[model samples]
Target: MLDLFTIFSKGGIVLWYFQSTSQIFTPSVNALIRSVILQERTGNHSYEHDSLRLQYKLDNEFELIFVVAYQKILQLSYVDKFLNDIHLEFRDRFKNELQSSQWFSDYTFKKSYDNILVAAENWGKAQAKLPKQMRTFDESFKSKKTVASMIERKDDKDNKKQEGKCLFTLVGKKKKGTNGTDDDLISSQEVLQVEAPKPVQNVNGDVFEDPLMMNRIKLAQKFSGQKKKADKQKSPKPEKAGKKPRVWELGGTNKDLATLERTKDKPEDEGDYIGADTTLIGKMKGGIQDLEVESDSVEESDEVEEIVEVNKSPVQKKSGGMLSMFKSLVGNKSLKHEDMLPVLDKLKDHLIAKNVASDIATKLCDSVATKLEGKILGTFESVANTVKATLTEALVQILSPKRRVDILRDAFEAKKHGRPYVMAFCGVNGVGKSTNLAKICFWLIENNFRVLIAACDTFRAGAVEQLRTHMRHLNALHPAEKHDNQTMVQLYEKGYGKDAAGIAMEAIRFAKESRFDIVLVDTAGRMQDNEPLMRALTKLIRVNEPDLVLFVGEALVGNEAVDQLVKFNQALADYSSSNDPHIIDGIVLTKFDTIDDKVGAAISMTYITGQPIVFVGTGQTYTDLKSLNAKAVVHALMK
Candidate 1:
């Protein structure tokens, strides 16, 4: 049974509603609108919020919405037919008022709604009563097969050749064949006589001259010779040498003890840390706001304008890039499933070519087809532009961030409260987790914020040294002399092979006590499938509770990357051992410059996690870190 049914205008006005329960559904409905409809995920057939399952339909021409809500456990079938029937009935009954801009007037549709609901329920019951039918012979694969294809032929010539070879010395008689050919037939008594011969001594005076014995001896000798050769080819092992400790050239000494002493922490001096300078802050902001992405060559044409124009169509453009090709199929009438299949298929291919996941592209095309069904296109309007516009809008909505992460502003807020802003970087091995972490740290320090890099990546060799080198370079760029004898950046590391969670916790504590502006935790790069490593990552995030947990991923990934993101998010949620587990907060897309226009990874990551991409790593330098610009990314994708 349906729990709620509603009809409303696109402008937030509830035209009419019916409910069987007193439960409040505003929150659930609003969630559907925000997360699915507003996010351009209309290709999805149903949405589950709390215990309710909601299905919605959009009336593009009339600017109306029809939604049916029911309990999640119920397997409802009539709701779709019921919604369709009611939509047509209500539109036909009130077409004049709908077109006259009289939306605020009262609608008396109770009788008509009940009749349509009952008819739909009856139709569903009838379908259930029918028995399952068997498929016809023509529908089976056997019906399409041929007998000739199933037969296997043997080669008589090869068989005869194999039989003609003599195996041993035997007495045989040649008989005259019918075709004047010779046929040899062996005699059993003669074969036994030949086999009864005695063995003879060889020239080496070592064993016997029997053919079987000689062959066995030769095989044994060959194996022994090969074994000796293998032994001779083996390389000698080198002697182990003593290990030496790594030395950093920037390591402090007794001569700099005075300068280091002034940088020491005091309880009451926590609030005295200097904030980021204005010039550096502006530079950081400009980098993010003005991020440049290379679009496709097709972008130079008027395609972008066409896409934008189609989006403004009366029905919100329920079309994709191929709508123009199939415009003749839906001329002067409502679109059916058959009419839209070719167009949707073409759109799906287009999206896949644009680097979208195959499954995701199919779903997006289904959604566009759903939005376009039962809508009539104008007689004189260009269908191609309309289709392009709708697909472009959906792509743009998907790329748009649901929530913004203003790191600079938030860091200052944390500074004012006399605490350190903590951020942890986690991802698979060699996705540039440490490299991007360094880039972000550079950006933070550039804004005059003192930063601490926590090297908790104790698993990989040289992880600590790599971070130390970056710390040294960053400090050199902003030396103590330029910052009133105060070091701009510091490294907190406990060598290698320690507890990463414990290290992160200690680092955060030290940063707070040292009055540092930000603490960037560099975790070990681990595969999503590694349970031990994933647990350690979960422990780090759960215990330290960093302000941001960024999942660093390579943009040069495809369908496999989807699995990686899903597994990482699932591991974080499953292993947190808490009712309110914290998963990935945002994404840090690495090697963005390498993938020219294959920006599907960005969409896939954001769609799976519903988290915004906070930082994009375009180049190898620290200055290459920038914020994601949704429009630029969409432009590149469409191109």
Candidate 2:
């Protein structure tokens, strides 16, 4: 103890105290240091996190750094002195075991389990510090669909690969009463609380003779047989809806559908590919028209001021909260960025083709159907959805008494005057932020606008290659790193067709040199510790005070996209001095042509974070970039 006191007085508490946690010390004074480090290793994860938080709370209390240090020494190093701390170990183990036993078996049966575990993991130990009523598991799981699933099978052999699944069929049949309480009352063959038949007084004060009780088992069997017989006699689920050969083929009624009726076994309906070749061609053509119309609508309506008319569905909207809403919004939806990007990108290209199709052909329902269907997998349900929506639109237009004229008015009231000239892009890696930046250079050159780029991302091995690749792809990009000194000279040469000091100066140098029309700087991923790197970014901003500074982040990031907005804002904390800080003028959500969980939470987060979404990466092609429109975004995500 005296030695420890000597160590503490020497300011060497941690280095001297080998009795505590095995950690030595961080180079800086940050209580959340290990918390952050451990966080990087786990997402939505819980493992002794609460205990650490509890320790943090205690450390902050009573000005007891050394006392807390000694407590931690006792707690973290308990294993070393196991014999003396057996009770502590036993207590912790028992709690953990109890939590484990009570945890959700699967997401379905896990309603209570997940809430309990999350509540415990995030705040398990906080109970000592926080109120018990506020920490109720029932309260935590009070959100919609928190405890509902028809097919939660608890009988699976326990091999916990995190969770298991069961698809349930809703079986609602009038079951026969068992034990013949009705029959027993009649026959006196079974025991009952009340006599088999007796005069009883009703709540309405009417006296009536009770009906005879029947044997429940026999009645149940009879009812069960009756249901089975009915199932055998009923017709199958529709293979065709009225006159229209249904695109959604009734596959020999699944167990769920079978409850209603056993669909009659008819000749194979090799669906989608219409047997009538003539009708197929007509539908395909109409599909093509639909695609073109939708694409054109997107491009045209983007400039309109969009009033957010939420889909006031009787069903809940998916944006109630992030974690809960996302799961529901993407029901049976793919999470991988790759799976969806190509599909959307392909749809875009298909639309582009339809847009260019002859005016006469564009109007025909058959042309729209033909082109869109050709792109669809014959086996997919989405194909039917796409084709049907198009046909429906076409029918409405044709059947209208007046030639339908959607006025295509500018929805946006043009921001008072016009718009701020900030530009950004959204798309996947190969979609070309660098190439587009260079193209903007040429566009600026043609319009006599000045522009310079800063290459701040030093992590990706091939990042330099991509920028240099832009040099070849656009013939306007420079092939050198930009640091602190030569940025002004490079911008001068780029703007005035002359060379400046060198290529690698501060980002501010380029902004200062040309500081007017536009100053484009390339950024990177892995934005966690953007501070150490912000000197270069700050130098660019201060020197040139460029009209717009855009943060270039990936589009296909899905849920983690929120992290980019957070980290970047942290890095640029100095700039956000006012109600409207020198925030990111725009966000470029890159990689639009991939299969990402496009929850677009990033866009919504932008609003919360006070940044504007200014551009979208439409495809893999260099020209696929488009201006951001809130309505367009809402439509894509909702559809």
Candidate 3:
């Protein structure tokens, strides 16, 4: 059953809250829920807390959290359907209010909340009557075993019936074999034994159904018949008693006997043959069978001696002949640009297609071409493969950071020095400066740091209110810790039309006095061509020297973002008198998830400005911000 349903902005701000029962809701409970939602690394939206289960459905701008409480398991499909319906209806009902800040003050919000509560109650009643069989995990597993046993018994019975039919066919065939003559039956058995088992075929020469089973039956019957015949032949027959009793009598002619005796009595020397006569002696020496035995014996003796010699000697090693020769001939040869012109041209096309800026792609290709020239290619490496390897290496080098900034480490260091770690965000208008500032504050809060947001963008009409709204939402998720009666994440806002630089300086002084660990200054969004606005931005940095200045840009802006950063840095150098000129320490890329194929902006920005991209905005939510991964970016670009 659905116990709770709530809607949250992407910044982890709870926009709407509902409870089905009379359960008490507390700030701690809200914090716990937010922690679960924010700390989720995998995209899985479901989490369990005690007997309650929480499932989240994410939209582009909002997240719907459904909480289910039960003693036993209920059908999740029903719960999902209920939540999805509510989400759609809520989106439709408050579409405009959700995007505007007026929803909090609008009187219609109460009526909308009441309507949603009534709908949720009706949905709960409808789901209670659903024909869903809720079961424990153990009970469901036992029922599955019962069904599996029934299936197994049915299969065994069917297999037995099949075996009976095959056996009956074998008996009928055996009767025909018994009626044939013994020699013919033996010859037929031998032929069947020698033949390979083939698939049963129909009259059309196509394979029959159950060909494998039929082939097994045929082979079994042939072997069984052969065994029976062999048994019959092995049974010894009684010998004929009178057949072996006959004996030869010595009745040979006297003259023939006298001649044989004379030849046998002759001297051994007279039997010796010489020269041409030796041919007849050789012919009479042995039969074909005897000669084959003698030749086999001689070969076996030679083989034995060879084996003995091999065992006595040490083993010889084989050298890599062909491989070594090939390596020597071509492995060390340097690559030339002319040799890889075709491959480089194709690579450039691929990069451009993947949304890399045109100039950046050309430069990348040129750099790769320069590195490839006079570089040794491995023995098995092809020109295309070598070029790809070199290009990946160069990209990795550019994307990789020389030194990483540890935000927590820096914040703690600032605390030791009795000052907060101050960071300011500057970028052109509509680049999501205020939203990203809240996101970083949320991150710092999650890391256990007390943070303060300075609303210094007094030039923009509703900027202060926007920052306050963000603070309201974030405070609900991670409430401020009270220090000397001052709340964490408190906003320092001067009304519109005030000096922006003075407001920032006051905010920093307030943070130092309040003992806050970090302060995020939200500066007014301005264009680089606006000279007065650019001067104001520079003055803010000079008056209140922030530890880090981040340039926020949209990845969808492509190569033009580089131009904005360059101009901003130039203005800072001209107006600021500090020995260390104000420069963008890192970059924050917004709408990173929206840029599906074109990822070249990040590379172009970093390569041009020589700054590292620190964080990327994956979605509108505060938790959507993630650390930039160089390898992941390169992989996405290459794809």
Give the number of the best model, judged by TM-score. 1
**Model 1 ranges with Cα > 4 A deviation:** 100-108, 136-289, 295-340
- Model 2 lDDT per residue over 353-465, tens place: 32212222222333233223213232333322344344334323322212121111110121122321323222223435665565444333333333444554454466555
lDDT of candidate 3 over 531-619, digit per residue (tens): 99988988888888899999999888765776787798898888778867777888888887777656778777776566778877777
TM-score of every candidate: 0.74, 0.31, 0.47
List clash counts for every candidate, in order: 2, 65, 1
Off by over 4 Å in 3: 1-332, 480-486
User: Which of candidates 1 and 3 reaches a greater lDDT?
Assistant: 1
lDDT score, residue 446, model 2?
32
Q: Which is better, 1 or 3, measured by TM-score?
A: 1
lDDT (tens digit, per residue) of candidate 1 on 1-639: 889999988798988999999999999999998998887788876899999999998887677889999999998788889988998887875596767866533345787778888999999999888898889999999888998876655776678775554333434455656687764343233332112224677788775556664454445445334231221366788988889898998898899888767532222353323332233333553335545788645542322112233556532333333343344422566655676676567777766776677877877777777667666776654344445567778877877788888888999999999999999999998999989888888777778889999999998999998887777667766778888888889999999899999998999899999889999999988888999999999999999899999999988877767888899999999999888899888999999998888888888788777888888899976677877888888778766
In candidate 2, stretches whose alpha carbon ends up further than 4 angstroms from where it belongs are: 1-436, 442-450, 456-465, 475-517, 529-531, 534-544, 574-581, 595-602
What lDDT would each prediction earn against the true structure? Answer: 0.77, 0.35, 0.65
**TM-score of model 2 relative to the true fold?**
0.31
